[model samples]
Target: MDQLPTVQPHSPIMAVLTEIEYESGMEPSFGSIHDFCLELQELFTSSGWFFYVFSLKGVTKDGITGLYRDGSRWTKSKMPFPDIVYNRIHSRRSESSQIFIDFVEKMNEASIPVFNRRFLNKWEVHQWLNSRKNLQRFLPESCVYSRNSLQRMAASHEVLFLKPVNGSRGRDIMRIQSQDSTCDVSLSSRNGIESLNTCQKEDLPAILKRYLKKQLYLLQQGLPLLKMDNRSVDFRILCNRSSKYDWRVTSTVARLSAQGHFAANLAAGGDTIHPLRVLRHFFGEAQSTSKLDMIRELALEAANCTADSSEELFGELGIDVGVDDNGHPWIIEVNSKPSKNDHIGKSSCRPSAKAILEYAQILLSETNPPEKGGSR
Candidate 1:
């Protein structure tokens, strides 16, 4: 496996932002996540504290020295040690899986605050975030799968979206619709749309079989979201918990999908607009502003609700909010690390990165207080 180059050790103040290096065995490149870590590092550095990023992958000085290896023994490095280990490892399989897990365990044992705390597992987080009672106002009818449940969902709704339970970036998403006794299916992709029409009663069994062979997925009733210029639109609400444990809205933007596309994801070629403008156009001057206010309230409520339920020390969240024809807001999804695409400091918005860094400082203060001679 290839390795990441390392930076030279600076003073202790500069070393406060070390990262827990993830081995290259992980599937997705850590570029985006790494950028986030760097953002946090910069934020901490400006706050009079040092930040250092440490990865288990051997630490190399400008791609020369390899301090660690796959089968080699671990050793203390000359680099400044970390006061906290942010567990961003996403590896599902590895030869050193046990070793990495142990490292995280040691960090926890040492009282270094971990972002997720490992208490709220992924499934638990999803269930809590998507619960009907908790987020009913902002969610569509969604149920974890079984063949019978999917068939029932198909029978009731004209169209439904089937998604992977652990999916992201709109991958492996399919739309199913009923047409008399026949059912139509469309697979979503960046390349183009591929679809098939089949009998609902007779074809469901085979379709379910094919879907089950892949992985676990969820069946969701399709929401009738308002559209702009024949394209569906959704809002990305960025929320973060300050050091004071108060949830604050960092930013919100309207993502409008291109014509003929169902997803409004940026990766899917969607364009972004101001939410205030989109809502005003969709609802008209008199009623649109009121609706926007309501959407903001609901977004903040959902963020607080999720933060209250989870035990993790999360400082930020990216929530996808959809507005129905009734001018009501519904949550589409909650992202742990919301992208900085339309971040504040950009065009008309506040810098979300700055807010996130400030929040992290607060969290760190709460978790790791300064010594008697030091400042928090």
Candidate 2:
């Protein structure tokens, strides 16, 4: 790997980028990203470290077209090679673009440390967890969706969740619940739940064939998740590696799904509640605190497990956990590029953003350590 130019340990630069459209002239902004930058700036002094936001097109052989604040206003300026590049590119199409791909390729070639490096698919994580005997208990029985796999799972589990292998935000997930004589399929959407009722059991294959034809899906046994007011609720724990490079739980919130939906993703019309409040509501005060602790521990374990398998540097993870009716916690999903939907205006989540910056500093030092002749 090529090496990024070494810099003074105390005064390294950090560059953050997301998709930018220069033609629109619209200010590049996202609520959570803005708050994150503000907090990162306040925590890391400008005299010590400089932070800049840029676009995909901004990157070139010379440097990045970075945006920095000049007094009370923002200004675009050419920047030097940063000690690290924090990629926040969100658009799939943008990431697939030749320019964006080249930028990442060059960044890697230059050995500029980038953490939270790439997206991990659902099937990949499930496979990793299943391979570990210690962690298998927390995972739902899952397998790549096939006609045989689907039929076998449907026989054992009354309810099965069919999820797109590479999907996020609870999109393109289907719930196949077997009723007495019919199978009810609920497809999750941004607008609302779309339900399909099949009258005959034999018709399930034909019905599912239509939906499962092109896309790859994972068949997971649905847990009897602990519910609040007839709505399923699960916890989303934000875990990050601190400056010390140890995993820590930063923020956790309980997501309550809409009345009939099984998915509790915030993007799927779910509401967020303080984890404790939701825990206490279901498990009561005595057990609620303990349950929260269990969730945190499992989250840390999941983070470490993934880090162990992946070669890429990861500084943060979003772990979704579901507590069964029996009070056992099940790992639902692990996200590499967790959404910032809940971070907006939530002071509690600021630590996660801070941890990312601190971890970046650690990576910078590891990649380009200062000489002993220089100041410690």
Candidate 3:
């Protein structure tokens, strides 16, 4: 076998595309960004990699107006665009702006690889993955929300989820359960589940029509997830793109919702813990291992399919999966801009930060390959 190409220790500067927000006295700060950004800086300190955060309007003909590291302090200044950009702009609305769109077009014109350029539309993603035969098994039955679609989906599944195509952090999702003649609708948000009161089955059309308005929604089949402590349990698998059609599972952890809660996302007050702790509770040691292995395999395959289905590039993803009581795995969702878990205890930099740094290096090496048999 041939040896791998060597990249220089002085890696190219990387830019994280984000939304700029100001704090007290106009001190710019993005909530919870420091956890991941600082980790990026600290991880490859000796390896000569520089990372900076900027927003949609920061790009220009000369350079970017972004926050930079000046020793231990962050200072706002003009800096040159880096070799690669990773999108972290939280809002899909901001990402849809003309400024962001133009930047991506220009980057493509320059042959710059900007992975995760836009957030995935849940309906579009479901169609992409569902259209593929091999991937369909892992996907729950879903359809673009409509009076007809919702009614159709409701007819099959006793419980259904009404998810906004652009929803995030487990916010603005509607859980509707059939109750003989009435529909019990509840909404899921970061705080917890809020009752929306029961409504007549026929009235759901008008109710959802006014509430959802023009925004797109996906009505999906709800899963019968494994529950522990009266709360539903699911797994989050962080995967990073290693090569074309190649993805590596970076971290796997189980998220358990509090009692009476429907969402298992950390943003929704869910708790993150080792997958084994919960898996072992349901199955024997060997069976638990098998279950986890199956989940990871499904996650990687889902990542590959999702990436392959997209026209743009993707360097990382957070694939959420939930296993049923029968030990079957189902794809919950795929997130391009996955949230970082600051609650996981700052014992050390989670491999997630390192995985991102390594993927950035891979991008650097690919776009600007090093000279053979030499070091910089």
Instruction: Tally clashes: model 3.
Output: 0
Model 2 superposed RMSD (Cα):
4.4
> Tens digit of lDDT per residue, candidate 2, span 1-376?
1233333455777777765444346665634467576566555544467666788777777766766654553457776566677777776667678887787777777677777767787888988888889889999999999879987998899999999887878887888889776898878777667885564667887888877648788999989998888878999999998754479998888888877676887777788888899888778999999999999999998998888788877888999999998889999999887777665343643777778777877887787733321122
Ranked by TM-score from best down, the candidates are 2, 3, 1
List ranges where model 1 is wrong by over 4 Å: 1-30, 33-41, 54-78, 85-100, 116-126, 129-134, 344-350, 368-376
Residue by residue across 153-230, what tens digits does model 3's lDDT show? 888888999998988887888898887889988888556778876889999887776566468888899989999988
Model 2 stretches with alpha carbons more than 4 Å out: 1-10, 21-26, 197-199, 243-245, 344-349, 369-376
TM-score of each: 0.77, 0.89, 0.89
Q: Which lDDT value does model 1 have at 346?
A: 33
Which tens-of-lDDT digit does each residue in 1-376 have in candidate 1? 2443233233222222123444655422234455555555556556655454445463333321112212223222443334444444443342136655665565466555556333222345457766637566567777877778877887789888877766666666788877788777877778545674465566776775665436677788898898988888999988877656677787788998766677787777778888988988868889877887777777787777678787666666777889988787877877764655554343432456577556655655665543521121
CA RMSD (A), model 3: 5.8
Instruction: Tell me the spans in candidate 3 whose CA falls farther than 4 Å from its real position.
Output: 1-11, 24-28, 342-347, 369-376
Candidate 2 residue pairs in clash (backbone atoms < 3 Å): none
Of the candidates shown, which would achieve the greatest lDDT relative to the real structure? Answer: 3
The 0-to-1 C-alpha lDDT of every candidate, in the order given, reads 0.62, 0.77, 0.79
